[model samples]
Target: MAILFRRVALVQLAPRLGDVEYNLNLIEHGVQRARAQSAELVVFPELAVTGYFLKDMVSTVALRIDGPEVARLASLSRGLELIVGAVEESEDYRFFNSALYFRDGELTYIHRKVYLPTYGLFDEARYLARGDRIRCFSSALGRTAILICEDLWHPSTAYIAALDGAVALVCPSSSPLRGISEGKDHDDNAAYWELLNAVYAQTFGVFVVYVNRVGFEDGVGFWGGSEIVSPVGNRLAKAKYYEEDFVVADLSLKEPRRQRVQAPLLRDENLDLTIRELQRIQRCRGTLGHQECGESHADCEGETDAGLEER
Candidate 1:
């Protein structure tokens, strides 16, 4: 009873800022539309519930995992699998920008954004707490990992997912369109994002289902361009840029199996070697204790990894 093929929907939506009720309606409609088309799964962009750039209004729209908002979201998963993002309020009252994966009408996995960018026009670290781990979980579509927003910018997140035997990397992001040129049709950041998606797909031999939002929030536009990249670095499906669009891609598990057999990069990844190198690096930086890496910096000065140097 292995699932080899299924149709997946990408909801490149634009949520009304701080309006959770309106966003819920949009999600319900999106689910109905996708389910009618016989899609096995549907994905939304990061912060889909509350919208991005909710500077001070973040808490006002935050939803607990067991709250009615999530219950309503889970209710959408009677037959179809779904992935959505929201501001999660923890029991300790800390909020996190998180992606929730639901299967069989139950909350299965929640991935919080780890690397919060606090630069010009981006201030996630100011309000949200960071996630500590990257894990691969099972679903009807097989093994998958959810990395929210800036988590995709860090290669280690994807690397860990791949190493943990993830067949698909599901990234929900709210990246704004930047570096607009007069003659160009797409933003500079959009092209770079496509490149990143392709690189991750081909390198890890895993399907990359990248769902990004569209429209404006606080005067900053988000170029949708949501795309699904195949294991061998091919664009399987792409949505319209700067507009709301729903696109479905029929994906087969056989492709990732074939890509791994053909390229075998994931097969060649040396986890033990990587761990040793990381321990050594940490020891050199005085972060690791003597038991794991070494007693002092001088003891590990000669130890180096080419991967570390290259990065």
Candidate 2:
């Protein structure tokens, strides 16, 4: 059998806060390094063009999809695939945390972060509008999807990508390190992320490429434990901790193909059942219960599964 493979590179770098030009230069250097390694694709950290934690300066470094900044990013693609995160400014004057996918020197796909975390140190909901669409597009390395930061935390995001026929899930994150682990030098969050990535990889039978940033911004530090996990839950490559590192890995299409034949999880997923349950759950909540139930709120609360089946 022929070995179907793609050499992938993950650049875990510290982006300069709110500096598009400087960050672009950093990305260019990464792309150059990737080309030297003969990588087919290079993935960068989230908001790589504009640093994270931009409260009111969201629009200051925002780039329109057709802008010169994006063109520069596109040019970096050249003969390879490039996934770079940036602040996208729409025509209606809204800014989004977006991942731009470039292949063969053209803009191919764009994924705007859907789940914007609002709690704790995250105030994204206050500064940016939420995205509603999640899609997988054609790429040099088969079908792929880019899920940014908090979007990967939601199981539905990865599920949708898997069902959409994505073989590779690329997640570009700007995650901040929370709570020190005494003498360990890394936080508890690292362990949680490793478990989460492995679960998604094995469960969905797809490769997981996670590229995270390093360095401190406004006193908060981001851990740079970037990694790539194979379809069978094996770590292909991992970057350095608390420092910038360029990680390279070989992703074989054979793994996903072999796993699907062994597991067939995605093939067996019941989409209709999931939709029905979601709609039923939606009707069981708040005003939806009173209106969508076609009966009294109390009656809806006391409804049985048999009654729902009849409806």
Candidate 3:
């Protein structure tokens, strides 16, 4: 494979909901700023176009994949590859949480968020349709895959993207604030960091760039730990918590190549096969009654044999 561009910048913008004009201008400004720094690619936070708290209004403001808003951004992105978020309308008239990639004065690719988060403050299931596929958008940089906030929390999507020829993973999120009102014991911010590290280091060994939103919205303040993680899972650079700024990092494509050669996690036993086998084993073990399950391996083996015979 050929080596691509080595420098990129992430724009962590603090955007408000239902503000289209302002967000468009802000994205254009961010692209220019990244170009000034000689960065090849510029990534913005998730849902930066309309803000994340628009709730039901997302459908009304959702732009067609070929609409004017993206066209304007594409024209403005002359020298930099820009990845920004907006609501996208599918051909079937369904709306999706989407990201548009603009490069070389045109729209390159669009990724609809695959994982629709329903827990806590998120109700994406109510507004946007979930994408059932994984894909990598071809860019001048390299084979790149895009994931929205919640998808990064799990390894399934990342591994699938890697298998599909993604050498770099870009995750854009509107991460909400936690721990302040819930008190000190609620500081589970490390979960985000830990998940990022593991995804970068263990599964694909590819470059992981995460861009997160900052500032408060509807009583939730986002934790801004926007960062660039290396193939070995080391955090190369990161933004401060609850602030707005840009972080630029120079990554040699040679790094991931070197790391993969040393530890080829991608070529390990097929995960699909492992998952199927595990499911089969679980089926054999059968369900246990409330208080009947214990440390007895004999009972478990007997149940497994019985279930297998019945099958």
Candidate 4:
């Protein structure tokens, strides 16, 4: 018997800066429309509840994970799973860039953004605390992991999630349009994301669902090129750039299994060797040519360092 395919919707919207109520209403409307279209899962862009580019307003608009607003979002997720991003406030008052997963009117999982981009036009580390964990969770759509914006830029996050048995990786991004390509066809940022999504999907044999926001905020315009990549690195569906879009595509759960059977990269990974090599590299840090272990460079020649070549 063939596995049944599930419909998923990617909602690309431009949220009002610092206006939590308005953004929530937009999310509610998107969820309603996705449900009307019989979608089993709906994904929103990063910081969909509170618009991105909140320099100082991040603290002012940070919300508790169990607050009334989140409760309202959970309520809207009846019969369908929803993945949305927002500013999460901890009990100690520290804020984190987070993604919330809701299913059957309940909060299923929460993935806090681990990597906070602090360079260039980004200042996330100034306002948000970093998340220390990256793990996948069971969802209505199957085993999945959530990586917010810059978190997906780090290869280890996705690798770890795949190692932890994730079949789908959902990413919510608020990437701005900065550099244009030489051909003037697509923004360089969008092109990079396309390559990144395809590489991760193909290498890990997992579905990649990326949703990005659109519109201008504080002179920076977000490029909305939300897309879904199949386990074999096929671009299943993509939303239009610079516009609010509701894109849906059917994803086959059996694709990952088929791809993994053909590739088997994860099954062949050597985790023990990886961990040992990373430990050796961590111990090699030193100043003025002095090794931490007091060993000379010549002494390390015989050691098999688990570098990129090992993969």
Candidate 5:
């Protein structure tokens, strides 16, 4: 059985970092336009609410889970399902890179980013704490898991989310693609990411939608090639790079179940065995120096599996 939906709109937003009012207006306008097209679900890039490169102002603009920004989003999403990224501030003053899911005028779930990338233009570790668990949120479409950029690069996170019964995974990213990524003989960085998304989609046998921001923020330019992939690891629809646009595609969640049943990758092995294999490989690299064999594992810094470019 292949379960198919009519349409999902992935909106590529080019937001100037630190501009809250402007970003909000864009969101509202984007929603109206998406509604005009009769899209069932509308998704925005990571940090679409307040912008991505917060620099030192991350704490200033960070909002509580039930703060006014979220409330406004809830109000704006009266007739549609929306996923937008924001900086979340806890009661204890801790902060997180978070994604909020709203459906039919109600705030449904908050997914805090688990892997914080501290290297290469990102200083997330300085601003946010990491999430401890990976699970799926209940949605009208089905059970779906949310992974902010870096989470998709780690196989364990996706595997655990799938084990937790996620039918699909949504990744919101601010991909820092600086140069041209077109033409036949482009750079490997672009190809690497395309492969990364394909791997997760194929391995888990689930639909994956990755939304990325466009335009340059501060000094870092975000590459806006938001894309959707089917369970068979084929790219279904992709938005243009360096352009603010929306791409819609019809997805079938039921087809993943059929593919998994035929492949039987999930039923064939145990997680412990897979972990052991990964550990063996890690030991070969002398990378197990930090000690991750136990429940309370060490920090996941240093060569963290090229977690999907949001870092």
Candidate 6:
């Protein structure tokens, strides 16, 4: 069989605050540049259309899934698949941090951010609703999954996507630079992202692509160390930090299969056993009528012990 190859682009651009038209025009220009280089898939940073740090402006600048702006993006993505981040407004006017996938002049899939950080410099939970589902979907570049910013920090999110047969994991982030790591080329935030990307790629035996924006907003600076990691956890391409850049790299579809066969982590995973163990853990919460059950108090205690032992 012939091996399939795809050229993917990671666009790290600074978005104007609350300026949807300007950001959209920038994105269109980036897409045109990527298309000129014959890129099959182009990915952008989180909230690339509306910009991050939009405390109250999120609701105001949120785009409907079927809004005219989306149509314009769909039209721009005529032949190539484009993954860009934007604030999505629901029918009831609720807003969500979302990533939209456009291909063949049509919106293919939408991944709403599941984990919204509200600690420290982040306050996403206050502005956007959380997404409930995480699953892999078919894309032009084979089975793929999208995780917005903080979603990638939770290991279960990537694990679920990997179990669902995702060959590539794409993450769009707008992470800010915080602290300085000694002897490292990037900041602490960038270093942590590199570690996370490598771990996920190696553990799941899947390609990992991360795109982060660069620029200062409200005195906070976003770090732009966007990168592409291979299935074996090798850094294939990386963009410069604290600057806007457009980087592209070609990936082989066979790499995931090759790495999976070498590691076999997915083949050894036990979903049913995991589910049963989780159920046991939940049952150990000790509700009102627990001791009245036929299993007796001793068995209930044993369930908790057994759950711990399984872990």
Which is the leading candidate under TM-score?
4
User: What TM-score should be assigned to candidate 6?
Assistant: 0.92
Backbone clash count for every predicted candidate, in the order shown: 0, 0, 1, 0, 0, 0
- List TM-scores for all candidates, in order: 0.91, 0.92, 0.84, 0.93, 0.85, 0.92
TM-score of model 4 vs. true structure: 0.93
Candidate 1: tens digits of C-alpha lDDT, residues 134-203: 8888865579999987899999999999989998999998989999767877999998999999999999
Q: Which stretches of candidate 2 lie over 4 Å from their true place?
A: 182-185, 287-311
**lDDT (Cα atoms) of all candidates against the true structure:** 0.89, 0.90, 0.79, 0.91, 0.80, 0.92
Model 1: number of backbone collisions: 0
Question: Over 4 Å off in model 6, which ranges?
Answer: 285-311
lDDT of 2 by residue, 106-145 (tens): 9988899999999999999899988889999987567888
Instruction: Write the residue-wise lDDT of candidate 4 on 226-311 in tens digits.
Output: 99999988899899988999999999889999999999999999999999877766665433155444555643442435465686
| Prediction RMSDs, each to the true structure | 4.4, 3.6, 4.9, 3.2, 7.3, 3.9
Model 1 worst lDDT run, 10 consecutive residues: 287-296
Q: Which of candidates 3 and 6 reaches a greater lDDT?
A: 6
The order by descending TM-score is 4, 2, 6, 1, 5, 3
Residues 127-216 of candidate 3 have per-residue lDDT tens digits of 889877778987644788998888877777887788877778898899886544444322366354547655665468788888888878
Clashes of 3: 1
The local lDDT score (0 to 100) that residue 173 gets in candidate 1 is 89
Off by over 4 Å in 3: 1-5, 180-187, 275-311
